[model samples]
Target: MSTIPLLASQLVVTTIFNSIESLGFSNIAGKVFSGEQAEARQEANLKVNTKKFYARGLKSLEQQDLYGAIKNFTATINLNPQFAPAYNDRGLARYKLGYKQSAIEDLTTAIELNPYRAKYYSNRGFMLTRLKDYTAAIADYNSALLLKPNLAQAYFNRGSIRLQMENSLAALADFEAAIRLDRDLAKAYFNRGVTRYKLREVQGAFEDFQKAAGLFKQQGRMDYYQDALAKLRQLCY
Candidate 1:
């Protein structure tokens, strides 16, 4: 699969299963037990099974066992097709396994199941960028930001896509927002420097590049630090 830039560190999937106990199952035990009691029992059983499979999937993902994670997530989905988190996690696993189209489908389903989740939109946006669907990706990023204005990753990712489109001013705006939200985001500074260079803002670009190099060094990202230093040397000297 083509490697795509991650918007953030791999988003933890555990949050998806956090509300399993609340999903009420259909009561099949009608007359023998009260409807409420039957439903409660069914829900409890479903929660146990779903949690078990979800936990297994999470462990597999942690081990980098993409196939194992997919299989377990699929089992969890089969038990509860409405489970948005399962679809989100399975989508992530599918993306890792190079099933980009399938991953998008799963993420779309997850969005349909839970439109309020900013992460779902952000995840789908990242996948769309991988497919080179820049317009759709930007729209998804917009939605994510609308839902969560404080999301630094969304700003950074959107800035990256803007940079690819040669929208230097917009890209700079996004990178600035990301930096405001998280001053420690080295890549945002680096990209901002690149955007400033594109706009011929030499002094600003130089300052950003220097800041990026210092932050990358502090974060132990030697490769990024080297790249920043190279840019500084090329521009300043």
Candidate 2:
């Protein structure tokens, strides 16, 4: 049976903490020397300001203000060029605002700044997937999984890409791994159902669709719930 692939493209966010301590200026408000001491005080003030700007950027991101988030993150990066989280978040904001290539560049910069962050690779993989760069996207997902073995979203996304490539068995394995790692991953169940149906496992598909529909309803995702229900109906009749 020829199978049609359904892919999901949702960008996931990562929460990161800044390592720089916020040094309050109260201690040096009145007493400050020249030369190296003056330069030290200036550096301390910049770190504090960088923290504040980074916090504001995170707040704006939470409030769904993409432009505000970008502006604040840019300030944070200007204050501290090596701050990887700022670049990562700015990339997220750019991606949301439809600046896909710029988003990818920001993500790449973030990765260069901090290669240990698994989420950075996953995020860039998502942008690559949107651009239909399946091979590169898979490589990014592979890197993410290698860095963090329990990253369920990476598995789900890789499975989605594999499905698109007509590798249904590999897709099924990835979806299963994702579902095992995160039971609440409703989309994983839904996609696994699609994979199962393509593999002629009608009963498995029916069960998966039912589970996906229930989970989607619980998550308040009406569109996905309706789609799952529709798939179930097709299997039933």
Candidate 3:
């Protein structure tokens, strides 16, 4: 019914052409159109296109049109009421539009619909973190970790929450895990550096600050980098 089916068919053929060719078929395209079975498969796939709406939403998100993405994602959810990603993306769109409470409800529903999705929990945790519900944010981050243990961002967010609570040891552990998973997280380095400074671990603090400063500079966030540098000077100069 839409161009999306064409895209999906192309994707499927691209991934499985070799196997199809080996089965006495000249090519996937030729074999795919040779019989009633193939025609029926295509018809079924074309009709089952809640995913196409979801894909359109993702494309809109990539274009930074949050409202457009929300519209498409909402359509996808209407097409298939149980689509978790559509709900998740719609929640994100609502958040960007400053509908904070609605975003929270949508994200919460997404988490309920698919508790195993780490991104849903992670996004909800971020919103909760901003809302100053550090306790709840920690719980959400913990849920994400349970689903995807190696998720570096979840550790970093959890670390931030622990840092806010002044639980420096726990925060440091999380930041360390985050750094292990992704070395490029400047915020992790900066926050960890601050925590180390509070703990009187001067060398550790200095190292973290230096790394964080470089990362900040790379990101063009020079003001914070300057602050970190000033702190470093106060620590060692």
For model 2, the local distance difference test gives 0.94
User: For model 3, what is the C-alpha lDDT against the true structure?
Assistant: 0.89
lDDT, candidate 3, 130-194, per-residue tens: 89999999999999999999999999999989998999999999999999999988989999998
lDDT of 1 by residue, 135-182 (tens): 999999999999999999999999999999999999999999999999
**lDDT of each structure?**
0.94, 0.94, 0.89
User: Residue 5's C-alpha lDDT in candidate 1?
Assistant: 60
Candidate 3: where are CA atoms >4 Å away? Answer: 1-47, 219-221
Note the clash tally of each candidate.
0, 0, 0
Of 1 and 3, the candidate ahead on TM-score is 1
Query: What's the TM-score of each model vs. the native?
Result: 0.85, 0.83, 0.77
Superior candidate under TM-score, 1 versus 2 = 1
In model 2, the runs with Cα more than 4 Å from the true position are: 1-34
Q: Which candidate gets the maximum TM-score versus the true structure?
A: 1
Model 2 per-residue lDDT tens digits across residues 194-229 = 999999999999999999999999999999999999
